[model samples]
Target: MLLMAITVTGASTLTYFVNDSFISGQLSTASSLDTGTKSVQLLAYDTRDSTTLLQVSNLNNKFGDQKLCGVSCSGGGLTDKIPLNGGTEFIMIKIKNNGINSIFLENIKLNNVVHAWDSQTSGIALNTLQDLSSGGSYPHDGTFSIFSESSIIQSTSNEIPNGNTVNLLIKLGSEDDDILLNKGIKVLLNIGNLNPVEFFIDSGGAQ
Candidate 1:
């Protein structure tokens, strides 16, 4: 079997205030080919607006094909619903295999989520990535910390095998309240093996 691995990672920072709502980030992937030339595509969605926020060319193409070995992002689609009134929200990451064969998802890692609400107000939250099969789905555990100032969120690493497609659902919310599903967050994908591959994103958010 062809062994292909894809991993994503990144960080995001958000500020909090009174009556504030909405915070988001993005997850991206960069792909590379080791042997043959392949076509790869990437797709992202906005669960609220049901829109495709990002659509790019090859994620891992070294021959000016606009392809990449993997992709990374800080934040992509930010909605206007994240509660800014000292709360939390959730972001979802969905990935697919637009190629002809199956790809492996080696692992995923999140640094941490830190908050800077104020000079004396701050906190941190940690989360992990769960694997879903081509047709399987999983919900991101909502474990977010909040403050009256600024803060950050971090995560650890998760792993998976090569397959046709994979989906990552991340839940973002504060320990006090539930975050609105408005903003989008960023995640990075580290893909192993350079094969001619193609990826695409499908969602109701598309035009």
Candidate 2:
């Protein structure tokens, strides 16, 4: 007669705390435009058109859900243009301020063509939310720095102090720039019907 036993386990390295857990796209100001309407309503914790963000927390994406970008994680569906063969990269999002008046953000409209903030190249180019510089030197300076070239995202002081959250940062361009392919980031809110919160960029493809 004989007997034996064995056991093994190892897996615990998932620390994504943007408030200790969040997966709900919330964009408001449409309860019939908040009844009686005085026009001055705009809200978004994760908005990208069609009231996106039913649940998102895997880097950045809630409008259509596509993934593939290696460096930041996920690299395969940014249109699948097949050209960027190198652990690809791209990640930027985390703008908050659930609402209650006190969100005067202004500017941010990338009309696609896949990542194009080439202001002559650098760590982060545009879309403003966050900026890093492992090889360029950027630890914190991404509050939407008024980037232009038709992307129009001015920022003297894009306020957002209700729930608080708006460091703003979006990145991409030159991962072997194979013409990138359909990138997006539009959140031009001045409140109310300031209209402009479109986010539809699915070209994470190739890495």
Candidate 3:
């Protein structure tokens, strides 16, 4: 039996103001492999374009001047094959918040699974969070079962302050065999806060 792993890295630049803050990040392919005897096919995608690249860079420069924090983000897609029959695979996501303030993650949708995590456990469940062909919310935590060949798992954590991090592990497999697979996975980290800060000028009324 042969196993392969893939890794992807991304970062978010933070901008601060009295109101309405902006957090921008990008996703790109890191590495992959062809585990099969013959070569398998692989594909990757990123939403940023020629113009968006410059825009994001400029935004980073602009935010560098203010009192802001940085986030080191990384994630990726995965797939694997079993020997005789097909087995299971898994992908893990680690989110670390090194900022001075707390951050919230809202509406995080991956492949299509949704859940919530915190700085402590980072949202790990005994049973896998699978999709239902009948259509439903899907289980957030606890034991559950599904009968889908493929699934997209995701979890959201809010108010993560400095020195805090979250970890998410996604597993795919059958009852017989399971492999820890991490490949072509996509990750998006939306870092921002909604709290308002007041500032007073030396010789101004409210400007």
Candidate 4:
């Protein structure tokens, strides 16, 4: 009976030791990963007129695309009532990333809007507000020296890190065709997978 008891105890010990070794090996080979969310916000919209981003009373409405304010949003559209011309009008869009990840400004596409008759073919440029404040050549004043140094933004390189903001200057014009005239200029600013912030500029006339 003593030998039998000793044999049973030894087997139990051996079983536990093997199980512990297996668990340790399994854990050592295991791998894990984590993920985060990407989000962006259109902080403000600036034009020659007195337009601004305002808060909407109801959160359920989805006709407009404005910056989300917690559970609600502001009405989205050009704040100014009067139409604007592409030549003299420059729309400054302020964008920020308030999410857990960074957002890449992938591209700037124009719908029904053509590039203005300027050296900057894209018609979408980086906002030169800071440069203009210090007498930089942002307005392009039809001078050869000023027109040569246009600050057109390149595609797919602009990065807005978390809590960082960027300003985009948009100036696109309508086609000379009568059908396309006054149809309005639509600017689709793409930032990766997120929905593009849209800007609809009513055409006062061609550039």
Candidate 5:
């Protein structure tokens, strides 16, 4: 006589995300995940482009010096950091299951990492992000922050359900700058099991 092993599964939904902060990340930060009966995980975009790309140099040349004509004056003692001469940029992200394991995605995390405007807008950091399905306000206003890291971002992402995909809308914000090379946005996702799996952010500007 022989015994057989049985497997069980449940229904789940894959969540896509778009994080656009355009801030330079700093310091190493981490957060634990929720370990519920349902298993969940988070994975990075395999081909990169997970975050937004700030076209910093694409400035519109259609403004007159309102303060003083024919003379360059420091506007408000600082250069206006606006993109597309006051236009907008929206980011949409999607994902698919690229692993053998089919699972659920429970939560995403954000650390108090530095952003491009942190110095100017002090206290504006990226924090925790909960599912809209959970029915709660995001960022929780002074609880969890979401930002990218200067180093490679590593987090454990659960296996997305096979043949599952999601279209997530990313918030769009424009910036102005006289400096070169600004950080777009960095998104680090933490799945289940503290999902706490470390994913990698390689060769992609933050969105």
Candidate 6:
């Protein structure tokens, strides 16, 4: 009877140690996974011409100035503003996913209004937008009004695979001439859960 009792206690202690070791291993694995890194890069282009190109020089060059001159630009030789004949102007954007996992684009929104000449001038509106990448989702209409610190401009189900760069064409609807005339604005564009991208646009005060 004494020998049997001693053997039982030894087995119990071994089982407890084994369970504790397994729990510790799981915690260690989770900690390492939480340290995974995420990175994103953005580039913007003018949709002045029918054929828009995302030049190699502009790829991942967020530090360089990517600008859109509105109505009239003087001497910088910047591309002229695309006409709103269709009541909308298109803005092209490129996003590179440099992360370990795929990025699910939840929404695109305006972060804030950096500038607006007219106090009555609210903000820009959207017509339609989409990711022009292969296997991309269908276009989503962003017909909602956009103001500084306002609600989301559009909701999307687009996904950006890791190590892939995707192009996005955003159709901006023009407001009344009284609102957009001679106005310049700086806007911050937000994509999904990633960092915001800033751009300066000279509206050229067009009527």
Estimate the Cα RMSD of every predicted model relative to the unseen true structure: 24.7, 20.0, 27.8, 14.6, 19.4, 13.9
Alpha-carbon shift of residue 47 in model 5 (angstroms) = 13
**lDDT tens per residue, model 4, 1-207:** 999999999999999999999998777554111111224555554332323311111101111222111111111432211121112233445666676666665555555333222333233343333232333223221111111112334223355577766555443222212212234546665655535556665433211
Q: Best-fitting candidate, measured by lDDT? A: 4
Candidate 5: which stretches are off by over 4 Å? 1-91, 110-160, 172-186, 197-207
lDDT of every model, 2 decimals: 0.26, 0.32, 0.24, 0.38, 0.26, 0.37
Candidate 1, residues 1-207, lDDT tens digits: the string is 123222211111223422134322211123323221242234343333221122211111112221111111112322111212111223334455455554433322222232111111112232112121222112222321121112122212232223323333333323212212232223334344543223222221222
For each candidate in turn, the TM-score is: 0.27, 0.23, 0.26, 0.36, 0.26, 0.37
Q: Report the C-alpha displacement of residue 17, candidate 6, in angstroms.
A: 24
Better of 5 and 6 by lDDT: 6
Q: Report the candidate with higher lDDT, 1 versus 6.
A: 6
Model 4 residue 17 CA deviation (Å) reads 34
Report backbone clashes per prediction.
Answer: 98, 18, 9, 0, 33, 1
Candidate 3 accuracy as lDDT = 0.24
Best prediction by TM-score: 6
The predicted structure with the larger TM-score, 3 or 6, is 6
List, residue by residue over 1-207, the lDDT tens digit for candidate 5.
122222211111111111122221211112112322123223232112222223212112223221101012113421222212221212223444444456444433222221121122123322112222233121221112222222112122323454444322222221212111222334433333443433333322232
Candidate 3, residues 13-104, lDDT tens digits: the string is 22233123322211111111111101111111111111111111111111111211111111121112211111122223344445444555
Between prediction 1 and prediction 4, which has the larger TM-score?
A: 4
Which residue runs of candidate 1 sit more than 4 Å off their true CA positions? Answer: 1-40, 47-88, 108-166, 173-185, 193-207
Model 4: residues with Cα > 4 Å off, grouped in runs: 1-38, 49-88, 110-136, 139-157, 173-187, 199-207
